[model samples]
Target chain A: MPLDIPLIGARTALWLVAQIHLFLAAFVLGAPIFIVISEWLGLQTRDPRYERLARETMKVVAIAYSLTAVFGVLFAFVLMGPYQLLTNYLFRALYPVWALYGLFILLETVCMYLYWYTWGPLSATTVRKWMHIGIGVVLNVLGTIVMLLMNAVAGFMNTPPKAIETATLWELVNNAAWWPLNLHRFLGNITFGGFVVALFAAFMFLTSRTGEDRKFYDWMGYIGNLIGVGALMTMPLAGYVLAKELFLYDAQLATFMMADKLSGYFVMQGLLVVLLFLGANFYMWLSMQRIEGGPRFAPHMKAVFGVLLAGGVIWVVPQNFFPDLLSKAPPGVSEQALILPERFAFLGLMVAKALAVTAIIIMTFVTYLLYRRARATGRIVWGRIDPMAQYVLIFIPAVAVYLMGLMGAIRSLTRMDYHVYGALKDLTPYWYVVTLGHSSVMAAITTVSFFLLLVFVFWVGFVMGKAHE
Target chain B: MSDPGTDPREARIEAVPLTPGAKGGWRRVKGPGIFALAGLAAIWVLLPMVSDSWGIRFGAPYRVFFSLAVLGSALFFILLNWGPIPAPGSPLTTFASIFLVYGATVGGVMSFGLWYYPQFEIPKPAVEQARAQERGKQAFLSPAANCFACHSIEALGIRGGTRGPDLSAVGAQAEARKSGTPAEDYIRESIVNPAACLTPLPASGLAECLPAADPARTYPPLMPPGFKDRLSDEQINDLVTFLMGLKGLAEQDGKSR
Candidate 1:
């Protein structure tokens, strides 16, 4: 946790490399299917529009395919560079899975290219559609399998199996956290892809000059937003499931994650959630205004936002502050620890639950109001450039990269050489900085990368998008 | 509304429609793509998986498969262009880079990779030197060799683990155990050959162990394995010099008697 610059930087870089590479890899595996589906749809409906979209989309997606391999190589180099020992140990235990992963990657690549290049060659309408589906299906299958294998490795680190008894490699490979992590990661990836695509669609729609392009762009944006939000909704669900599993498997880690001393922090966290809910509601209302007139339909939005903000402020107030007032009750009363007890802890949990419920109610009301307004007006703005949706394209990726950087330190802090969950060894040499310090450097690098991404995209969009607006 | 005169349903249908075979020319260009892709997928599933890596079952069907895959893939890499398809091209480029980096890596840091890492193929110790070191360290002090008493040692028969002095440590000061005067010199003069500086003592570990010349001094001689003729002059001197330096336990009194 206290890693210096170089090691943390190196570690962060490695994690970044891994994330970027894997994300690309996931896309590489998923995008062929996107093409196949588009093409297949075209064939089935006897529509050339779908076919054209598939060809052009495939070209755009090909850029991603080419870049992904570079990231993959970097990932391997980074893994081997700093964390060589951890890499080898992991390789030894989970070599079987890695080998399989390599094979799967090869299979995926061959399938992807063939599916892409062989586009016109598959003649019969029915046969080509079937072939297209086959490509999509295989790509998904291979991607899911690779992810599962990697998840097994990650899970092994989190909740180790009983490999120590006979110490066979399989026990080490089949870890407890694998399934939960895979499910979480799988959902998260879909959401990430969906939102990004939605944001892109929104951008394209905002910038298009022609009626057809604008319509297509708007539809894509709508689809992208839905994917982003849908995935986000499930993220919380997946998060809860992951938490429950973590608590059941390792209570000490769970307790540490929610330190007893940090009750005030918990309250503040609760309050922040409430605030986010309100902001999200306003944003969703703004999003729906493409349909609804927004301000008129969601008339109570400002008041609702205010109330949510006030509740957020209240939540933000230290939970212990009240107890503190009670404790200093104007007499020679002996003081207790600031927190009341387990009952109070349970009370804190309840408050958190209440906050979540309140946020959901606000969101639902906003959604309903917007829908009603849109239906009443039946107003369809043929073309309007909405720049705000594009903002999300920059925001989500940065936040994810930042959060991932933060969590990367957990392994460095918790795991020891040869004995993962055993007692923390007394002798940690100075060389640990090689891994720890690298993570810090990466976080800094990622921050800069994000800033550049935003500035460059915004500058380009403003320059290019005048006509459509 | 009866169109009996016009044959109503037939009249409503198109007078003439285009033939289904109209798109055959375009379809001709696209036909073989299906089989080409199928062939590719089949190749992926059929490759052999074998390596020296643990649990990588050897000398089996997989071995044959592995051989074929590696050889075939290598051949494919060499002979054909494969249309500059991105995946294979990328790996080949990376392979070259990895090799260059691996060379530097192996040069600088030790690892477990065969021919590259020291952990994998460590050299075994020589049998002769190993046997000699074993002789000097432990076997020479065994019960078969009575090397204690007059030349005292740390581990020996019940003599309070001391008598003459501890010779256990004489190895470090082998030169000082030779013939001489005072401490090293005295030890040096006494060990030129066993009888050269003969003392009045019986064989150690016996009930009659005693210093010589006193009739009632019934003590065993503490003489060790005779180096009388076995040792050369320079070697004898070195041995005496070494023995003399083993004087840490000289003042220790025997409690085992």
Candidate 2:
């Protein structure tokens, strides 16, 4: 934190600005995705309920979109003011992309308004609905593209590569971390929208004096929840990937994330993992007795959850407290980080690697078995799609898992730059073990839980449906 | 074999439904504890209320954004009809419509604040930023950047405009030529920030005409003072960057060189 007053304030201001921009941007990206899911669900199933949801969601989306445009203008003004220094610094090289960003923003705005306004006047033929969906996808693409450009500059500043001087806007546009972030964030946004929208729909459901409105909102809430949980279940992988990028980009930042003095954030993150897993696991357990096909799947999820609860506890354990007293110190205690190997060291060609592979296989087998009965119900009840569309949704979560893995691969650690770390002469083995071990466990649990959540949704939809016969 | 006649609602209670629908909707799914959405909206509204209590400094920009979020959420809730509207007669869209007004009302006031706020703290005259530019230009023609190294600016400063191109004559020339052309303007810009236009030196070949002062030293072409901090957004724009365009003078100064 060799921060000049102006620099720290400016950086904090920039992050806040970025966060604000991101918040608005997320709303824009997400609301449309929600609209599309409703359309796709409605269209494929010929369910007017889905159609009604789509129309209703689109109304909210239009208002949100206009607000997004308005806030963006506000953000631009802030960029000119308190964040002037940071914006100016990035603008020097980011001019080209910034231009595209301008054009893209214009394009997205026009399309969103036209798309929203046109919803009533537009026909609902397959082609038109597809076009509506297309507009949404393109808005997302353009919007995300604009954000990716901004992300590139922001990400570059945080972890600028050497080719910076020579790199054109395009090259920097496609930074190493950019796509993973795009992938991760896109999934997360869709997921967040689903949850938030569901919460909205659920409110409508509970309050509606009329049964028809109640059911309508309830269905919206349920589907919204599906998207939210599905996205939530898979997000950790992206976070993991992003975390790795954090490490490789700035080892110190990664160390801050892992086990440094700002350990609360790490603790929060671990606890998040433990909680998310435990939550998902409990849901799976809950779903087992209730789902249409699953007969004996309840306790197994409990076991997995029990394991996760243990991991959560393990995640919260203080780093390096125990081993410090037992071990004799190495020389030049100040350079102690130099004595102990990096967190990556333990992973380098060892029995640790073998166990990782074995552990993965075992878990996969268990999850596959757990979900077999659920999947045995031939038709996917909820959040199910045609093979082609499934292929598309598949890319989202698939990319999510890949990118999360990518985040953790490299090691770029700068000791929380702590004098305390130096005092220890080496990282306690416990700290190193817990850090990687917890992350790996988080990954395994998320992956398994993702499949479980996916199954859980179908189970809910199937069981929640009235007697069709 | 399974009974095709079975009630589906009793079978799957696992999913949290996001899109409650027009038909076959969330009637009576077998599960319980499905919290209603109004309560959730209350929580949504309630959770962020604690932000003020967090003891963080959210600047004017963030304050504006937070206001926008409140507006946005209000609209979302209205569209959804959160728990209950305060009044029975209220339209569902009223809350959101209100925020739109909020965005405009607040955003308009803030825009003006942004425009005028600098005057209060700086205590400088409104045109001081402009005068700084002129002072900078006065220094520019002297030994600032050696336009006199090749060109000249008598019309530019107290010094006669001969050592450089006759800038005193520039305004008159642009008027007389009325070719509706702009070569002289490009000249000043080139001398000051050379990278902008590589327009070859004037016919006098006075390209070597840089100043003696280290700030205006030769080998490093410098024309205007780099008062990057002083200029307003409007002032430092491309038009201003272009103002140093002594288009004809550089060529004239070059030929003399």
Candidate 3:
């Protein structure tokens, strides 16, 4: 049955809830992987700094775990209510997978609470420390399984096997886009977790009073940024593989995504990604200032900046002025002129854009190498970074959040006018793909809402810690 | 007392003894090496731009070459600068540096957008028709319509799937398919209502026109019957226009074939 809520409508309501749930879920899943790494590093190097960072970040994750669950339940309610038909069909089709997802969630929850609560107790002995790390390893395993289980459903919805009705459960789980989406989301979670951690560290660094606190937070921010940026470098390649798989599954769907309905949305995505690269690079350059011998390579860094800018320009150029390929140039404006000229048409092709993306990634790596070299030559004075660097650190996560929301919208909208793509059509009044402008506004809202809630999560951690103290 | 120009924190700078092996030997060639690499990349980029103006097609190979050259230059620059320099600057200079990179990024994207925007002038009628034909070609190739999949226009170098007869000369063939039928009317009927245009066979006793090609070979009724519902009126019209413009091969080419 067709359904609509009063003011916001069912689709928008579901979008908001799903986006929030996904943001929190990503943090919930992503934080443990890195937190465990930090814990292990502390044990290896016997650095109290790593342990403190891990324990502090775990507090935020512990609090966010509940928020993720609340939103997940709310998301379910939205799906089962207005989107009853779709929910029912999906449940009937893959109840086993859903059950497995549930089981994993329970295991993950138990492991997470244990790992967080036992940090202090477990550090008393090396054997216990390893045991705590073992718990973390189990938690990460459960989280990854949960993510993959969910990806199967999403990937199947986008690209159902040709004989879907009679297809075995194995076939359903191993759809063309399943593994690619799994890899993409896996890398994305790490990147997301890293940036969010960095954002937290930046906030702490900005508000820190004592030099020691500032120094600790500064070091934490650097590690977070490094992990985030390092993971980010591989995301585009993963994304490319995912897109290729989707295209291979259904040429029309891919065309709809890249050349038709969602074309302009990608241009906006390009802008966000450009902001992320520029912001990350800018932070690194500013960070170099804290290194004794960093300033000598300033000119080289400036040249790299130019290359990144040029690549950004290429990546954002649209093949046509209008978002939709079928759209005509406005009256009095020649269509020929609106279209990319023949000589420059090659710039709009995938080859050129791919090359541009490669250049951007390479330049980012170069900047990181320069920073490392500078460090090796002299010493890095922690807590000496410019305040602007902290602001840039904060900016990167905001852009990352926005990018995630936009990409999620694109992925869902690729099934345009259908609930399960070609298998089950959407019969609602709001079946059409929304305009790029509308989607961008929705993504902006999601980004703001996510950050506001994240601030709450951080505050809860802080308040609870104070109470314990 | 610390100098007023310097940060007070600089007074606490930790000194690290540099390894003697990592001294200034590499710095002598680093600057010149990076310069040479950057110059090579610039030349690769400029070559295509200059060659394109002279009507030379560098094609995919040259494009890939230039892309790699740019990447190589960046990599070389990083490798050469693997050493030490000076300290952090004042807050003002740092802020300026941050803004400069961001400002350039924004300005670059906006400038490219503006450069790509069309001039506000109407195209001539021929240009309009050409645009329509282009749109029609896109629709034909589009996955939604997928007309190119079953129909090959060998004259246009399209080797379509072997589900239907070659339509390289459909414009001329359509007019000759039936008596007292206009080419446009027949083609439109064939698309929106495929059943109406089925080829008649003496044995099967159907009542449509003869096959466009060989008398014994008849196309199966495999064309979609819902183009009217699937495509907009303008799209169908554009497809028709694009197909109508496809004349048969030149006399010599036809004879050779």
- How do all models score by TM-score? 0.52, 0.47, 0.68
| Model 2 Cα shift for residue A15 (angstroms) | 4.8
Docking class of 3: incorrect
Better of 1 and 2 by TM-score: 1
DockQ of each: 0.01, 0.02, 0.03
Best by TM-score: 3
- As for TM-score, the candidate ahead, 2 or 3, is 3
Candidate 3 chain A weakest ten by summed lDDT: A333-342
> Candidate 2, which segments miss by more than 4 Å at Cα?
A1-17, A245-263, A281-298, A315-318, A321-469, B1-257
Please give the lDDT score for candidate 1: 0.44
Q: Write the per-residue lDDT of candidate 2 for residues A1-469, one digit (tens) a residue.
A: 1111243333233333334344445645775776776677666777577778777766655555554565567567655664343455567757887887888888878887777777755545778878877776776677677767766655554455445557666766666567667667777777656654554463344334444564456446546655665676566567668767766765766655454423323333343333333333332332233245553564464454334433343343333321222243344333222222233234323244334323433433354357545646532233211111111122223223322321322221222211112211111111122233323333333333333333233323322332242
lDDT of 3 at A402: 77
Candidate 1: tens digits of C-alpha lDDT, residues A1-469? 1111253444456656665565555445444444566566666666554565555445545556666777778877766765554566567667888899899878877776766666667645677768766875776787688778877777776667544436567666665566777877787666555544543454454344456665555545544445444555565557557656766767764553344222222342343233334324434554443442534654465455445544443343332322111224224322222323333343335466556455555554656566555645544332232333333333333344333333434433333232234311211122231222233344435434433433244334442444356
As for lDDT, the candidate ahead, 1 or 2, is: 1
lDDT of 3 at B114: 34
Instruction: Choose the strongest candidate by DockQ.
Output: 3
Docking class of 1: incorrect
Q: What does the TM-score come to for chain B in model 2?
A: 0.23
